[model samples]
Target chain A: MKYLDEYRDPELARRLLSRIEEIAPGDRVIRLMEICGTHTVAIFRSGLRHLLPSTIRLISGPGCPVCVTANEDIDRAIWLAKQPGVIVTTFGDLVRVPGSTSSLNVERSNGADVRIVYATIDALQIARATPDRQVVFVGIGFETTAPTVAAAVKQAAAEGLVNFSVLPVHKLLPPAMGALLEEGNLQLNGFLCPGHVSTVIGASAYEDVVNRYGISCVVAGFEPLDLLHGIYLLVECVVKGTPQVLNQYRRAVSRDGNAAARRLMDEVFEPADSTWRGLGPIPLSGLRFRNSWRRFDAGERFSMPVIQVREDPACRCGDVLRGLMEPPQCTLFRKVCNPQNPKGPCMVSGEGTCGAYYRYHTESL
Target chain B: MKQRTVQLDQGSGGRATHELVKGLFVEAFRNEFLLEMNDSALVQLNGGRIAMSTDSYVVDPVIFPGGNIGSLAVHGTVNDLAMRGARPLYLTAGFILEEGLSLETLEQVVRAMGEAARESGVLIVAGDTKVVPRGKADKLFINTAGVGVVPPGIHVAGQNARPGDAVLINGTIGDHGMAVLCKREGLAFENEIRSDSAPLHDLVRQMLEVCPRIHVLRDPTRGGVATTLNEIAQQSSVGIRLLEEALPIGEDVAGACELLGLDPLYVANEGKLLACVPADEAEELLQVMRRHPLGAKSRRIGEVTVEEPGRVFLKTRIGGHRLVDMLRGEQLPRIC
Candidate 1:
């Protein structure tokens, strides 16, 4: 905890706030977007929004990995769990994610073989443990998680485990950002890019977004100051009418993030038309295992039927994710859906905006 | 006469469990004081000072390295009192036992509680117990309430934190959390990540003996340092800045957290306490803390400030600052 505590120095943080107040003088409405779940949680958890001047608004973005996972994809994973001799391995967050009619938890209650695994290696180990069963890892999340699953798929391929495969609903984040900017629902002035994702895709991946949108993007660590500094930098950019992607989390994120991991991801996955929860299907926004690894693809191995599902009658997760609505704004937020009995994907995951708001901000509301 | 009995879930309420207090607790711990046996206890003290605290213990795998839920109940309650600069004096233990829990295990936990109370120089003179059917309780659950008397004229509370006060920690954070996590997750490792579940009131006592005007005191439990600091910040209406390097995280824990994608700052700890002291007194307090076994690795980690009220900022070793948010949702259920 040595080098870690200084960044939390309240005095320094205060000084930075003053500096920001001075730099961004007058009533200028500066809207900066932080596109990471960690950032969003930090903002709410620490009451960071109150620290900003009235003119500055921190807008939430589609940064949560769980929030973006399409319902159909969740249903597809649930479908695999129902099949005989099929074992579904996934992250803890995915278990509670609502599908069309049910979730993996519901499936588990109904006697399905669904297990939560911390790493892809765990699934590989599971496949090794139960040779008679087909272990399918529901690969979700963005680039930070994809490489590990890609590695697992490669392992399954090399081992020639006929029973092991990955249902890769893996997403690429940059493309989605572009799609969001094009839609122009909110005039996003700047971006507070995710540090962990940056650790995979590097700071440069955001360069085009800066150039195209003429907005500043700061790759920030999940730390409060890193975020505030990123916002400060963004404010500076808007004031100067100059847009660029700046790397503030230098220790972990670089211009080129973990190149070796990125290479592994590229080697395994090819662009595919993947569906997003709120955004629908964006072209080449998702990944599929390469043709060479087709044999190791769980989507191909399992006969999953195409299905359309309706959102819960009252949930406003789509609007919540789009920053169009807050948790209290949702009719079912604390009523029909809660931490104990989540009705939608937004209420399930810990990183879900609605879930965070429900647990912490409900008292204030 | 009260006899050994089973424990029931709190959800079952006052009935079904047949838990009726006989006023033994009120008699043993009080000296011509505390007359009634109402739903809550009321005590009046001489004009010195007072501190009151409540805590619950529901540790699964029930027992582990260093301690069990019994000693933990004592430690947790005592520590809460300690945070307010109060030397703990009395404690009450409440139990909710699953129907099938063994008498042997129950005795062992009680013995632990007794030993911890004895060591911390506190007494558990009050008690309650209830029994629930199978699946209603997780082996055993304990809730403890404690009261302590502060010295003549010392003011200590969450709201006392002032800007520029230094933040100090007693030893490392997250051992208890990682210990529970590894065991709960069935993660085997070469090194034993045991829980740091020991009574911290003694450490609190030592700290106060060395310096009385400690602005703020808290043991970062449950959601870890992140949540605790946020609470303190809101209460104090101030900001807390932490030096990433100043944090005392164990190497194995760092490795384990990184591997598991868990944040150590947000991980729970049972034995550690965070203190916000005068900037000048932080180093001296750390020196005093180092002399005690509980705070052998105690160091100054951060400082309180007035800049951004109710925020916890983490400055990394490499000079980049990030906001350390309190865990919004439960990280791992039943970690305690």
Candidate 2:
């Protein structure tokens, strides 16, 4: 409450709004991308988008882990859930994500033993309780969540729990940013980086993007005021022609991040070229269990019949993820790819760009 | 060691059944009406109209931080009767237990129910128990039916809301739902959040005494304040406009909602109530309500309007407006 209450103060928010309004209208349109799913929701929930100047456009990036998860990985997880004696556990968002043919939620209704877990440690508890059965955890998230999965694997290895394993689709942040920079279709003025992920990877992680790509980057918290302040800072950077990496959420994030979490991640997992749904395979963006920890890898433990499946061909989630198109711009956004019957992963999760846009901007679409 | 779980034979109307009905039920609820042990509770009333309501509670993880399913069942039924401007008097409980449930858990639930009934100044008159084999039922399910007497010259209904009515709530939103969710999901925060699961009948009585012209009295339970407001709006055929800044939500609850991607407006509450009254009488009623224990944090949240008949709107904190629609289903936590 201490940190949260102050950040949400209405009075402070009003002052910041006035400041943002004053800093804007230099007659130059600015395109800023908020590359975090949390920011996307905050922008909508607080009605920050309406408060900002129309000239300043905020784009949703490929930040939602579920939205960016490759189709083959989701299909594999579904197949694992349907296997005999295998109990698949995952976060709640992944339940509704459409795979090649069926989703995990459909598999669950079809009598597969699939459970939603809030954390990976719960999967270990299930495996420990049911010694005769196999517990496979679907590990997904960015650097913010990868450490916890790493810790769970290390704990499993130490306890020698042969029945517990992870089908980790964890991704890194910086490499994906690099890939987005490489695709130079949209003209972007700056970036509002992720807050929680920054606490783990640190503000220094964005230095490479700022220095090499010459883009202004600011790590922001997920409050209305935090977002307003972040946008104001980005606008100022653009107006001043100063491209630098800044830390706006200094209360939680530091320059170096959590050193111990980084150590744990480095010990249990190694970098690998993994396929992102929209971004293709970004080099060293995904985390894979090291050879010593291969026994705890669900993909290695169970033999999955290779299911070559593609996402809905009509879904422009790839374009949406790259900020090339808004969700409503897609032909299937409201008609075919709704939250109830999501045709793609972007519309399945709440943090997904399309889902957030559909929910918060109900009047527009 | 003795068998820790309840057996199917326990509900067979045999010796085990008698022990449970007497040793657990009778001992916990030591009242003369329950001691009668009849098929129906013979409650003597002074010839007046009585309000009766029934509810069933099947909350997962039956035992939570603030209360269990037993207390929740009693509170839910009592609140339902109270919404009709009635004074709750008696309650009946029927429990369906899973065979593998531990006797200790049953005792704990019964004790919590007894405590809640006593606190609400009501008596448990009659009860029933049944058990099924393993996998047939969850740990426990409770059903409660209540009877209360409506005070003379008092009327409250959802359709009573007029254009100039004021919408008021007892306290903060999303505490009960988020508390249960945190406990269920094994989420540990800096401060341990307990459910605000308290009875509001006494508060309602004080409010009615001050302003007998109260139009509507409903608890924001399952579908939360937003759904309840929408229901009231449609029933009354009047629009309701709520100020986003006027809503009372705790800092932790707000933080948790932000983390889980849930709207506090749609999250459930167990102990809070929404009352609509004429604009002039709202201040006097709120004063009386605040004097009561349960209504200290009560505030006027919105006002009924005639503009967009049968609709609800929220003025955002940043001066934007958005329509509030009925929640179609549960607000599941985001997967990421």
Candidate 3:
């Protein structure tokens, strides 16, 4: 707790809070979007909203990879899970997300071989152990995780693990930000960029967003002080009319990011047009297997009939992801949709906007 | 549609576990004792009050850093009875061993259990064992039931908590949980986390000696301090406010929880207990608890309040407040 406790100093946090209050413009409503799922959870967990001034509103973005993953992708993963002798392994967040007709959790309960793994290497180890059966790792995350998966794929190829494959649903963060800006649905003064993702992709990645939309982007860590300081920097930018990409989490992130990780990702994958759950068909936002690593692609290795996917029309997860509406505004927020029995991805994923709200903000309700 | 079968979440000791207990088990065996729903059941026997509790240990790795399933079995049941302000006297253990289990391993586990029972001043009066096929059961599983004598004129229950009462914890939280998780997942940190799995009957006895009017004594095991506090709040029809800065947590445990994207409040602890006592006697009780080794690091973490009945809130370090709700399903690691 050496490094962590220092950031959570009560005296320091008090000073930062007062500073933010003093500079925040009181005449107009300022909307700041935190573009990382982890930040959303941290903000709620720290009760920062209650402490912040009334004029500044924090909106959740489409940074939760599980929430942004389209239903068709989940259907395809469930279809792969149902195939005989195929073992499906994925992160725990994706297991509870609902698909068109079924979810991985329900499928697992009904006798499907779905396992929750913390990392892709665990899935690879399973494949090496059970060589007779197929082990398909459902890879889903942002740049913070894609490089690790890419390393796992390279390791599998080197070891010639024929049973190992990956259903790569990995997404890029910067392009998704562009797509959100293009939609022009919500007016956002600035953006709180993801910290871990910035460590891999760097602070320079948001330069395009700033150049295009004139929105300030502050890369921040997940600690309470980091978030408060990040918001202060964004508020400062808004007050000064300076739209620049700032790095408040410089302790972990760098300007150019991790070069070796970017190289590994470039070697294993290529950017492709992919469909997001709410923001559909963002160009070059999804990662696919490069020509050399095509054999590890589960989509190419397995042949299955296309399954039609459907979404509950009543679930307003789309608007929640786009920052167009708050989670409590949704009709099904705490009614039929809840953590125990989630009606949408936003309610299922722990980092989802609605899920975070239900966990932290329900006291007021 | 496929038929619903028992899933892992039902055994997670969270909301799902509560549902299964209330919707099925408790409903089938409805009675005054079951209705109480405290950690242990208090029954009258020969004009004396007795506390009885039972628990099963199915930990994946039969052995862990601080204790094994055998010792854990004893401590778990003994602590359950202690929560009722009873002096644990006798225990019964049942084991289901896998066919492939080695004789040496079984002896080691049994020896540990004997030592733990002796240390806690309890007797393993009865035990039974059976073997199953390798695929049918894990390496080992243990079920322990205990009966203890409740001292006369001592009444402590969850619902007895009153507003303006002070809440105290015995020691650090999340040690047992993170220890088992790190061992099971092979997550090696710079320093290894050891489980705080120990019997708390002695501490409970000393506490009751001084503060006989102690309102509530409950172990924060599965679903952790947050969930246990929520249950107490609902039962007592009061609000509990925890100070984020005052809650004791080990550095190693905090680091592990941060890495896994888990809250320490919701993590499990075996040797930790939450006590609610009158505000006036809290300082004296704290001094007595600190004299015991098990409660050396004990601190007053929160206080009972009249507002927001059936709710538990944590006052953040930055002058903000958030509700600490009960644990839902299992705390899964984040995708980041």
Candidate 4:
């Protein structure tokens, strides 16, 4: 509560809001896109958009890992989970994600040895403790989490974890971001870069987007004021005709990111073409185990690639992730895909854009 | 709602889960105030005005260390109404029942709700029950709406925390969230973790008597104190700063949060109130709160500032400053 209560000073927020108003006094319709699932959830749940000036529109992008995760990958994870003598280790969230007709949760109920873990280090520990078990780590998430999983895999190899393997579903943030721009699915002016992901990928990752797409990018922490400041910086950049990556979260994120972590990631994995949920396969958007770590790679060791399947016909998660339509516009939003009975990834993942809209958004015209 | 094979998460639409809400929950404590059969409560203000509030509870496992959803529903509803400077009065309940629930489990929940109401001196005057068919609803979902009469002299709102105002929270945070996680995850501890779920109306009433102009009274529930303070800052359009070392967190909860890669400040709490008041009234209010069981660990954590308004900043234990943002998405889904 020490470093926390002060930033929430209502008077400070007013002053900041006033400053923001003065900085962007012109009646300009600014559309700022936050390219992080975390920021989208933060902005929506806190009703930050409701409090913001109507002129500023917050558009969600391909931020959610699960949202962008391809259908084939989920089917594959499900397939691997059901494999005999294989103990699938995954985050609790993946268990409920719908994969074709069955999910890991269903597989578990029907007798799959799937264990939920908070970290890959735990998975390595499980592998170390259970020599007879083939503990496959269901690797997911973007840069922020990839390095840790990389470190875990490196440690596994260094420790000679013969029975350990990783189902590498790890993704790269920038490529997915570029895919968003390439598709022309979103109209955006500037971007609020992700903080945690930036910690691994570095602030420079957004430079490509800023240079190619002419969008101002500023890495931001998840705090309300931090977001406001990031927005203010982006608006300032747009106003001044400047386009570059700025680090608003200097404490955690650096220009070069964690060097040791990056080294581990490089040693363990390489870029490869990967499929996203809404967007089709983007070249080099995913990470896979290097040849040296092939034995620890679930894809090669388990003799399976991600199952290719069509996206659910009823789910409009694709449009939602692309920022083409609001979640309320979706046919299954509250009717068939309510949180209590989720029918899609958007309704399932806590960080999904649709879930964010449903929980915090009020359908006010 | 239709009857179906009772399976975990199944016919909440009308199987075992439905019978629990209608037969056990509705049967035991059904009342007129909740039977309006409207989308929401329609209360006619008798005096100058009435204070109304909405609270949705999704705390998972539906039960925890010292309490379950039953007591949580009672305390959470009463506390929300009390924060508006109202005499905690009546509440209406809506439940999302899951499938395959047991009869004995439903009885325990209803009985707890009754006990909580009797202790808080409030009634479950009106209510509606729905079945989601099993596997659809998580055990049960309770949404409560309450109406209270604000006293003539008492005035409280988040927008009133001015510069030179003092900020305080009841006891520690992360306790309720951690306790629930401990029980649900089957994590064993040296001592049993317990939920601090108790109605704050009595404690709030005593505090009002001492400090009638208490600017804000809020239970830091789902988003914990970090989220609650963020709400207050934005509402009051004021800046807030707090000392980190002064904030309270139970040792076990802190440990669990660290282990789970979660910040305790961002976790949920079933029963915790954050009171923001002017500096001059801080001492007396603290004394009054201390006299009550709920506020024993209550202490002044921060102050309101005119500069940098609408931000919650904290001086860390490491002698650093950072922004404390409101929790964005569900840290843990189905958690109240």
DockQ of each: 0.08, 0.15, 0.55, 0.06
Better lDDT candidate (1, 3): 3
In order, the Cα lDDT scores of the candidates are 0.79, 0.84, 0.91, 0.77
Q: How close is chain B to the truth by TM-score, in each candidate?
A: 0.85, 0.84, 0.97, 0.84
Please identify which of the two predictions, 2 or 4, would achieve the higher lDDT against the true structure. 2
Better of 1 and 4 by lDDT: 1
For TM-score, candidate 1 versus 2, the one ahead is 2
Give the C-alpha miss distance for residue A334 in model 2, angstroms. Answer: 5.0
Q: Which residue pairs show collisions in model 2?
A: A93-B335
Under CAPRI classification, how is model 3 graded? medium
Best by lDDT: 3
Model 3, retained fraction of real contacts? 0.62
Candidate that scores best on DockQ: 3
Order the candidates by lDDT, highest first — what do you get? 3, 2, 1, 4
Segments in model 1 whose C-alpha atoms lie over 4 Å from true places:
A25-27, A360-365, B1-65, B68-336
For residue B246, give model 2's deviation from the true position in Å.
2.7
Candidate 1 local lDDT, B27-131, one digit each (tens): 556643233222122234675566667767777778776678888888888877777777889999899999999999999999998999998899898899999
Sort order, TM-score high to low: 3, 2, 1, 4
TM-score of chain A of 4: 0.96
lDDT of 3 by residue, A1-365 (tens): 78988888888989999999999988998899999888999998788898899999999999999999999999999999999999999999898898888999889887899999989999999999999999999999999889999999999989999999999998999999989988887888999999989999999999999999999999999888999999999999999999999999999999999999999999999999998998888999999999999999999899767878788899999889999989999999899899988888999888999999888886462
Q: How much does candidate 4 score in TM-score?
A: 0.64
Candidates ranked by DockQ, best first?
Answer: 3, 2, 1, 4
Interface RMSD of each: 10.6, 8.6, 2.1, 11.1
